[model samples]
Target chain A: MASALARTTYNVFFRRSSNYLVGIFAGAFAFEIAFDSAADRLWDMANKGRQWKDIRSKYIQAADSEPADDEE
Target chain B: MFTRAAYTTATRAAFRAPTFAQARNASTQAANGAFGADRKAAAAWFAKAAAGSAILGYGISNYVVTDDRLAPVTKAVAESMTALQKKAAEYGIEMPFTVAHAFSTADHGLHPPHYPWDHFKPWKTYDHASIRRGFQVYKEVCSACHSMEYIHYRNLVGVSHTESEAKELAAEYEYEDGPNDKGEMFMRPGKLTDPMPSPYPNEEAARAANGGAYPPDLSCIARARHGEEDYIFALLLGYCDPPAGVNVREGLHYNPYFPGGAIAMARAIYDEVVEYEDGTPNNASQLAKDVSTFLSWASYPEHDERKKMGLKTLAISAMLLGLSVWWKRFKWSYIKTRKIVYKPGKFDEV
Candidate 1:
């Protein structure tokens, strides 16, 4: 049963028709190229591998500091 | 009878083959020759194979792709026209193709405040508690002028509010409905599915409320700017008195993050602006962080789900490619070292 299934897949992919080979290559390549870069866009949201509050404390004027005092 | 006859003939022929180890007559050899029949068979087989492949390719294209495949990739498919345009441009002949943006902000020499979010390193997601607090800030402050027109009460179910809480929250607003049986429009209680109502009726009203400048919608603010969520946090905290050396304009606020260091909208966030229900800090910086994270989630709600799906897709494809390679090698190995032999052919004297 396993051998028969493998043979069917093999024929569909590599031997049955040249069109199947072309479609497989196009589909695989499109998904690889498009999805890889599209997924990377989401990763841009990462901010120095820390939460927003941690990053905020670094620059935000602390409440304890006087209004006139300048933070470098 | 025919089978017996043929068997008898084959036997008689075998018996006569080596009577004296003499050469057979040319006519007899020609009668048994296979070269013409083999050539005819090869041509017929290829004709059928070609027709089959053509039909299969046509059928496959119906599902895989219908339009021209090159349309997506070709920047300019008319290679001749692009070559001509380049040549003409090089010769100082300008065309009307390139248009510049109106009111491009000039550099003010004020450097941008430093913040993280420059790289694709590590990972990020909105803090749910922070997002809830941010929603409070928006409801109490920003909602007076700016609006998040795209978001719906239903969207808050898992991210910020419980399902029943979201339904109750949505019920507070009165949304306008279609014409009734009397041909008059009527007001209806807002549903969980209803979009957040704009603070102002129109753009003109929104602009009038905030001087001449219209407060842009915050629905996609995180994505609209290149800086993403960090820029919004910085902008809220950026407001300050103008530098003494520069002339301060009337009715404009000072923020170095603003392109010209002048902004129409007054500073909105302040320390202890909103009383947090969760007993979290209510400082300006804390509020800014929470609000920015909320806006980020609003811009990209399904980011976590998307990333999970992308990881799964990539892993599955990688496994498929590996399996396909192994299968190809396994099947082709049988034919790799195969050889064939044939008997030497007789040639008639030229």
Candidate 2:
């Protein structure tokens, strides 16, 4: 009975350890894909001339004038 | 002790390799191969490892860390974008642009560039030529946009004039809504009741006039920028072709001494933009010096008096503190030296 119990424990440990390794690899791959997507979005906004108008014209006009003194 | 020895032996057994000589020989062979046919492969593996690590690092750090990795890049991008703006500015370009202040309403954002404190050379009094030039810039250039909302007429005495002279200068402007005959509200001369006016009547009018660019009120710009008198002085002079190899994008012009080096204001001063009454050339540097001085004075009109009072208070406090320390030391010494002679066991014998 004790021998059978030891065999069962060994089998359970081996199965779980193999699954953990597989899970680690899958998790890493999923994380990489997500990271790539986010990086692409950031790159588009930053370097690729996404909204030149918002960055350039609006504030220059505001700087030349004055902000609204009236507050809500 | 037996268990510890067994554990150590087991760990060593797991780590044991072949004979030392064989291991060394194998390692040498491996090194030779590594330098030869395996070099490219090894380098590729290293590159792959680095790339993988960077991706992982980016994921973990970006999620966990609040610090921005792209600040310098963001700053560069903002500066570059400014050149595309077509606002009517005194700078050479005429393009304009707009965005909400990159800084949040709760935060004033980044520090503007300025001359290092170590670079400062102190002057004894107002440089008259600079002062005259400053007065001109103040009256013409800055007066059009900003309000010196806190300054009182009584504060202008020391910058360019005596008290009586300041009063004469003060007499030029009048105040509104003063005390009535019944000690209620009425109108009066521009005594202490009035602050400086906004260049525009109101925000809508200001925006309409400037093509939607809101010129910041000058009232506290000097203070807000953490300027020394010379900092303002340097910034005005520092405006030029954004320093060599320095890239200013879109609407931003680079002035190295400007708190941010990307002051949105068109470089307003130029060589001979305004003819100085004192026969000084109205060069950008000279105008900058003058305007900086005038702005400083305008920001803290009674600055000289306040500085003097502060110095006097400091000196008095130092003297008092020194006297107190000396007295305490003398008292302590006297107490220590004056040993009370007494018999140890005779309580009532004295």
Candidate 3:
């Protein structure tokens, strides 16, 4: 019965819906890419008050405080 | 005619069990199932859209709040300007009188609001009082709009206040937040214990408040404007209506003294913007005087050290110039006397 439901007739019945959903998914992927890029640039520009060296040192110190990750 | 009854009976038997309506219903159900599945897919897609929008919103908020990349550039510019000033001096040239002018017309780069360097006519009442007034104004008014996020709480003491005083001042505001019990997150009040809080929660708030005007940080505004208290004073005072029949030049706003001067901060502070706690008048000149003094103090908070350094530099340079002049005279005389002394064995004979 499952095989029968997945037959060529299924494609004919559902092709329009599948295409519509796939297009929406594609749009979401593109939108996320553009949004991430813009967000990165804006964050870079706005949080520029701290000196690079200072921020780097801070991050390094912060990272040092965290336990090392051990993977099998 | 007797066989017709038999044919009708055969037809009834063929159509007895399954009706034609049932076949039509099965087809409609298949279509409806497909449509329902599509609607579910669409709903799942919409949920993803909502999640993506949330992430994007978070990203934008983070971007608006962060000022991560400006520090290096600011430091580089400061170092470059210092080098240029020294080089100019070495070449017997005066560096541009105003930092604003230099920034506006520097051969190196271009920025908007391009008022030429000519706006900087040197008016030397270059004193410290004006800076004190500016500080007062800052404490009273401008600080409300602008936050010196780059400046440390202790740096205020570097200006004039004592260490204890600075500490006391630092104790005023609470900072944002840190890890809470159970290692969770939450907002906390800022303290003078913390660095200055950004006035706006984010850039959007800043833009929204000032009609898209970025009221620049006053921490380095005085320094960036070439350490000129008078120019700062003049600009503060210059925000006035242009006089009638005095046509403002193209690409310039009407400032009587600012060279090709135009400004966007719509004449913010008039003569009597606020009353001084002390006996100082709230008049324009008084406001200008106080604010200028405040700005000067801000520009050179280590005012005494700067003055001492200036005096020392002046004394050394003048001494060198004088010594060079005297050395030249002495060399000329020595040469005149030694003309014959260089004649072989003349000194031995003497």
Candidate 4:
């Protein structure tokens, strides 16, 4: 069973060296995307109430209710 | 005939085939044709073998990296790294880490506790109402000793007071003006342009009045100190009896929050020290909180605008991040998914 699995793996990924190179490049690209998104999510969770997203609604409501001032 | 015979003999000697003995002797000489008769073919074969080995190495590496058998190992490593990062964030361990200064038991004072100020969060702005009350506190209490030399009466407009109100507040104080026609200085009512007036003319006068301990300017005190607003709030109410075996001088008061467990400025804020115009409680803690917030605003006048800009920046960055991620994937999809198949005889025919 191990020999058969190895033969299949070689045929799929290593028969041509270009196939292996392409697979590595694709895997790295996918990993980068996954890691970036996961890190972003973790950061958002950790700083839940401190971020602007958490208070944006309240800020908008306050702004809408109050008369606009001339001051920048 | 004699010259021709000598020339022929010399040519024969120079071009003669090696004898058996000479060939054996020349065996140790370097070979001239190390690459053999077809050097190009030998080099091409070596290049092909090197390329094949390199491809084999890349294939082995790719297989090892993507192996499902090592998933748990990779997962554990990633988890541990993230946990360490989380711990660092929790402890506020900034880069170029240094140990916190240790206080000696002989004279070290108490460390102030962190207060949850309304504006403590990155997205939060100063409580304007509290700032207005803080201004009242400063005007009534701290201004007697400390000068806000960097603050002008006009700065109050649209922040804590209206234009007319700021003008009126400025008019309450008197400032010395330039020489008159008689070359004598004259006094004029303060204007919007004038800085907040100091209680004393100079540092020496201030020191003489306050028993050699001149009150520092409060304009930048919030930022100058280690604890900022938290230290100010604690110091205002930190006064207490000295612990056992400690001696406070005649002029100095014992405040555990102040460094060395003693401060020249005595307990300034007390219950009902100043009445608030908005009918907020006149307790000592509330007074301390308001004044600390005011001082924080004094130190960072751009606090609200900075937070607002931060929110805008974060929002824009989030949008750009999403768009760039999508754009990158879209651009790479065709190259990543396309398959190339070879027809053996077609290239030869071409």
Per-residue C-alpha lDDT of model 2 across residues B1-350, encoded as one tens digit per residue: 45888878887775555344544455444553543546787788779989999998998778755357567778888877764553335456655456555653113322444543221222122343454457667767777676666665444433343344345555666555747778888555565334665577787887777656567677666676655556566555556775576677677667766554666666666676667765666677767767776676566555534543454456557968988865554444433333477766946855
Among all candidates shown, the one with the greatest lDDT: 4
Considering chain A alone, report the TM-score of candidate 4 relative to the true chain A: 0.63
In model 1, what lDDT does residue B137 have?
87
- Runs in model 1 deviating more than 4 A are A1-72, B1-124, B328-350
Model 2 interface CAPRI class? incorrect
What's the residue-level lDDT of B29 in candidate 1? 35
Q: Which of the numbered candidates is closest to the native, going by highest TM-score?
A: 4
DockQ of each two-chain model: 0.07, 0.01, 0.03, 0.03
TM-score of each: 0.54, 0.43, 0.41, 0.59
* lDDT computed for candidate 4: 0.76
Candidate 2, residue B148: Cα displacement in angstroms equals 3.0
Q: In model 3, which runs have C-alpha deviations exceeding 4 angstroms?
A: A1-72, B1-130, B180-195, B225-228, B242-267, B270-273, B302-304, B317-336, B339-350
Model 4: pairs clashing at backbone N, Cα or C within 3 Å: none
Ranking by lDDT: 4, 1, 2, 3
- lDDT per residue as tens, model 2, A1-72: 147886675565445878657767887899667755664454334433212222223123333333231100
In order, the B-chain TM-scores come to 0.62, 0.49, 0.47, 0.69
Q: Please provide the root mean square deviation of candidate 4 (C-alpha atoms, Å).
A: 24.2
Model 2 stretches astray by more than 4 angstroms: A1-72, B1-132, B152-154, B162-197, B228-264, B279-281, B340-350
